[model samples]
Target: MTAHLPVLQVVIPLMAAAVCAALRPARVAWAFAVLVSWTVFVIAVLLLREVLAGGTISYEIGGWAAPWGIEYRIDVVNAFVLLIVSTVGAVVLPYAGDSVEREIRRDQIPLFYTAFLLCLTGLLGITITGDVFNVFVFLEISSLSTYTLVAMGRERGALTAAFRYLVMGSVGATFIVIGIGLLYSVTGTLNMVDLGLRLSELTATRTVPVAFAFLTVGISLKLALFPLHLWLPNAYAYAPSAATAFIAATATKVAVYMLLRFFFTVFGATFSFDTMQLGFVLLPLALVAIFSMSLVAIFQVNVKRMLAYSSLAQIGYITLGISIGTVTGLTAGILHLFNHAMMKAALFMALGCVIYRVGSIRIEAFHGLGKRMPLTMAAFVVAGLSLVGVPLTVGFISKWYLILAVLEQGWWPVAALVLFTSLMALVYIWRVVEAAYFHPSPTDEVAAAVREAPLSLLIPTWILVVVNVYFGVDATLTVEVAGRAAEALLGVPR
Candidate 1:
């Protein structure tokens, strides 16, 4: 059973998703989805424990050895990612029951749960697989389901957003496939570990750089880093709030993980950093993404859209850490991956509760929410404070590491820019706060009628907010895990 945990993490969700699609009753589908997600979460926790205590676990699918057959490799890096993805699904599934019932059509509920489970499966498969081609397969699985899930939004624009994402996402996936094909032609193996070994032998080849270019562009699109992020705001804005919260929390984080896996694991530091000089290219782009997107987020009228752009800016922080390419820098990047997941998930879930009550997520809709829905507004405030990098919030821990990483490279100017961006975050967060608390309600009826969100949504949403503060105050687990994961990626002793 222990040896089979790798396959179980993904298989349970994949199989359960099919069952959900076939389930006649929507309630049953929800129950199955929640069960599957909880099981995956447990498997992920066990996998992490094994990796931390015993080191990497390499499970050859069907008992075939790696390089010849598909492999599911569990290591500290992917184990942490697995935990993040599965944990989000576990939380979101229960929350989905209430949120989906309100926003999605009753007849469509089963399909929504099916798509959600499929997305969960794909993310876990991408994290667990050791085969390069399998990554593309799992990526498409997630991307396809994500499009369906996004389009299920009651908003008419949801279809358009899903279409746009499908087009852009398809192009990104194609580039990744082309890059993988090029690597396969050069190295003659689809297994990432074997490819890594062979790739070192072709350091001087032109195809190597071409493959790198294709991969970097492809992953940047998937992760929605800066200029390539046009598909993100609308997708988040139009999707059902539950879909927005789950995808916002996990999707791009998984893409960022893929980038780290390929850049550090497959290509190696020497080729990626020294030969290709990725830092020169990525550092500038990341900086642009941080400042430019934050500026754009401040001007948005829709609160959900504003938070979507803020999500893009946060991705810039993760990318910037990778661009630095040192152990401390990588640690910062990886840690932010986890921290931002908690903060953004909590924020979006809070917005979902607002949408449930007011049937909208516009800044105008939140005119007097603080007085009516104090607990919900408080959750938003806590998450917003974390976004602004307030002390004792997960956001502060991420920024602290980012600043330390920047200083490690003697780039005081860049460090200052990071601080400046935090102030920008504060400005945008303040906008929401002012609207929620200070502004008068649009009407007396709205002020009189508004109440707190149902307990189902509030519980999951606040659990994440509580986690944001809890983890912020106690960073031992996150720091230790991320630090070791960073060392492993850098080929240094933990």
Candidate 2:
């Protein structure tokens, strides 16, 4: 059982998703999904413990050996990613019952849960698989489910958002497949570890560099990097609240994980860093994304759309950390990977509460949120502070490390930009706070109609908010694990 933990971790949710699809009762399906999500979280925790205790664990699918057969490899880096993804999935599912019921048509509710579980299964599979082809297969599985989930939005425009995301996601997947084909043509293998080994032996090849370029661009689109991120705001803003909370918190983060796996694990440090100097490219784009997206967010009238743009800017921070390309830098990148997920999930879930009572997520609806829905808006404040990178929040820890990472490289200008953009974050976050706390509530039926969101939504929202603060004050766990993951990927024991 212990030996099969790697495959079991993914297979459980995947198989359960099928069962969920088979059952038609939305409530039953939701219950099953909640159980499966928590179970997956436990399995992920167990797998992480085993990996940390025993180093990397390799599980060959169906007892077939690697290089010839499919493999599921577990290491410090991926194990940590698995934990982050699973943690978000588990937290989001319990909150889904209320959010999904409110946003989705009754008949489609069961399918929503089914799609959600399948998406979860796909993300976990992508994180755990050691084969490059397997990554693409799972990417599509997650993506198709994502399209369905987004289309479940109550808004009529949700179909457009879903279609747009489908188009962009398809293009990204196609590029990734083309890249994999090039690598296979050069190395005659599809397994990532084997491909890495073969490439190390081969000198510079036209195909290899082209493959590298292809993978980078494709992953950039998937991770919603900068200009490629146009599809994300719509995908998230128009999705069902539950879907938005889950996807915003997990999907792009997993894509970032895929990028890290390819750059650090598949390409190796010399090729990705020294020869190609990917950081030089990522640095400028990351800076632009940080500032440009932050400015765009400040102007948005819709609160959900505002945070959607903010998520893109946060991704910029993650990429900035990666662009620094040092042990400290990678650690910051990975730490923010988890930190951003926590804070954003909390924020979106808080929005989920507002959308519950009132259908609109516009700024005007929140004019008196602090007074009416005190608990939910308070949760939003804590999470918003975290988003602003305020001290005593998870966002602050991530930025603290990013600053150290930039300063370590003597890039004072970039460091200054980071601090400046963070202040921009405060500006956008404050916009909501002002509307919610300072402005007067509408004096008509609108204010009379809106009430406090149910505990079902508020509890999950606060859980993440509390964790955001708790983890900020005690960075021992997240920092230590992220440091080890970074050290493993960089091959430098720090």
lDDT values, one for every candidate: 0.93, 0.93
Residue range with the least summed lDDT across 10 consecutive positions in model 2: 485-494
Residues 1-494 of candidate 2 have per-residue lDDT tens digits of 77888998889998998899877678889999999999999999999999888899899999889989999999988999899889999999999998888889999888898899999999999999999999999999999999999999988889999999999999999999999999999899989889889998999689988999999999999999998998999889999988899999999999999999999889898899888999999999999999999999999999999999999999999999998888999999999999999999999999999999977889888898889989999999999999999999999999999999999999999999999988998998898899999998888996778899998888889999999999999999999999999999888854
Model 1 vs. true fold: TM: 0.99
Q: Candidate 1: what lDDT? A: 0.93
The superposed Cα distance between candidate 2 and the true structure at residue 441, in angstroms, equals: 1.0
Residue 307 of model 1: what lDDT? 96
Q: State residue 285's C-alpha deviation in candidate 1, in Å.
A: 0.5
Candidate 2 residue 124 C-alpha distance from true site, Å = 0.4
The stretch of ten residues in a row with the least summed lDDT in candidate 1 is 441-450
- How much does candidate 2 score in TM-score? 0.99
